[model samples]
Target: MSLRRLLLVAIALTFSFLSSFVLATPLHIIAAENFYADVAKQVGGEYVSVSSILSNPDDNPHLFEASPTIAKSIAQAKIAIYSGIGYDSWMSKLLAGHSHLTIIDVASLIGRQDGDNPHIWYDPHTMLTFALAIKQQLIRLDPAHQASYQHNWQQFVASMHPILTDIDSLRQRYAGTEVTATEPVFGYMFAELGFKVRNLGFQMAVMNDTEPSISQMKGLHNDLIEHKVAFLLYNLQVSDPMTEQLKTLAQTHKVAIVGATETMPKGIHYQQWLKQELDAVQKVLKK
Candidate 1:
């Protein structure tokens, strides 16, 4: 046989073998938030396909409105993951028709109920719980790849050590340090760091899409101007005139500003993203 013909036959055989190996298409997963999708990708590896509806980091998830297209996507998915307890309420409404689909409500997984803080992913323990749960789900969905899923889950758990260590170091060095924010997007992380977060009324008002009372606004202003807190967490995902004003005041007063987002941003893994944010906190507080 000619040399070129032999090479072509070898390539054809290799392609056929690879095709048979993954004869089953990946399990389709739809996540209401991007962070969950990121974690799903880590645990499921190539066995599951994940799509996130709330992938945009700049938009406020609170204002998300579901479309017929979104409903169709949810209907076609084999699994749907979302943050329950009023965080991604629109996802619940859209998923009502998909009773057969395996659903993972992350908030409820950790015993969070309605009226509790919905940003549960900010807590390291919450993500760990979610990683294990998703790993189990992947194993059940594709038992053929159980070993691969287990190995990936173990790697993910190990990668979390740096994040936990950073949090612990910050907690030890800065416990009871006061802080404030335009919104409570990072409330769980702040609590993990042992911060006394001020301006609850204002934060709740913003989260609920209501105007903050004059008193609430004044209190946050004082916190910024007087440097009552070690830093101010600026929610870059959501913005209104009031929140914008607080950000400006924080800048004017020279209070340390740490910006946080609601969803995981593009082109970053879950573990690295969390570590970078924690590092930002350490850097600002060390000043």
Candidate 2:
């Protein structure tokens, strides 16, 4: 072949190979909690490679310590997600130097403040919001897969319809039903279902790692013993002697208990996790 023709052919082949490789590369996503990771996966589908920092159900998110490995992952990620408002504050510090990353703070997206309950995943709407944000960011990051991202977002939104319907159905059927929690982990869901949550002081204290006031403790005990609360949504991820005592009191009074978690448990999708918890609540109400 002529030298000029050979050079042109080689350049064309090189460009083609580079284009294919770039197209096949998935967007790297890092979520502080598994639930957010799960949502990003659902929304990004095969176009993303997701990693979750907090995947264990037993770990306390409040006590999360960021390591060099985690910092490296954050630095490498094209997209990052975390619940702000003090839930995963460490993530913010780690993310500070990674200004190039597209950080999605769920608390900030949902306008939740510092004192607000940070378990934003329990609220279906929060996931919906995050899913949309993920979709937008993915589209921006990989415009070639814009259609795929949109389709995934639509499917995710469609999937939540049943959960929303279930919430409405439960609210209509059991609105004003009394419920309590060891912590406010599932408070948003409880409120959405129209359950009258008692012992706010107690829940806040436990969530903040402070001791509940004597009156708050007395109120929680009385509510369980008197059957004033129909169920106790306990934070199974964390437990001290005090929370364990409350659990015993609930069991003694026959108050149904549903365990809630800060992170999405292993072997479950985000939608499944929410549905399972809602189903648990419904079962308690049925009983």
lDDT of 1: 0.88
**Candidate 1's residue-wise lDDT over 33-152, tens digit each?**
888999889989988888989888876788888778878878768889998899888987888868878999999899999988788999989999999999998888789999999999
Q: What TM-score would every model get versus the actual structure?
A: 0.90, 0.92
**Deviation from native of the Cα of residue 278 in model 1, angstroms:** 0.9
Q: In candidate 2, what are the lDDT values of residues 77-195, reduced to their tens digit? A: 99989989998889878899787899898998989998888787888999999999999999988998999999999999999999999999999999999888898989889888988
- Best candidate (score: lDDT): 2
162 Cα displacement, candidate 1 (Å):
0.5
Q: What's model 2's overall lDDT?
A: 0.89
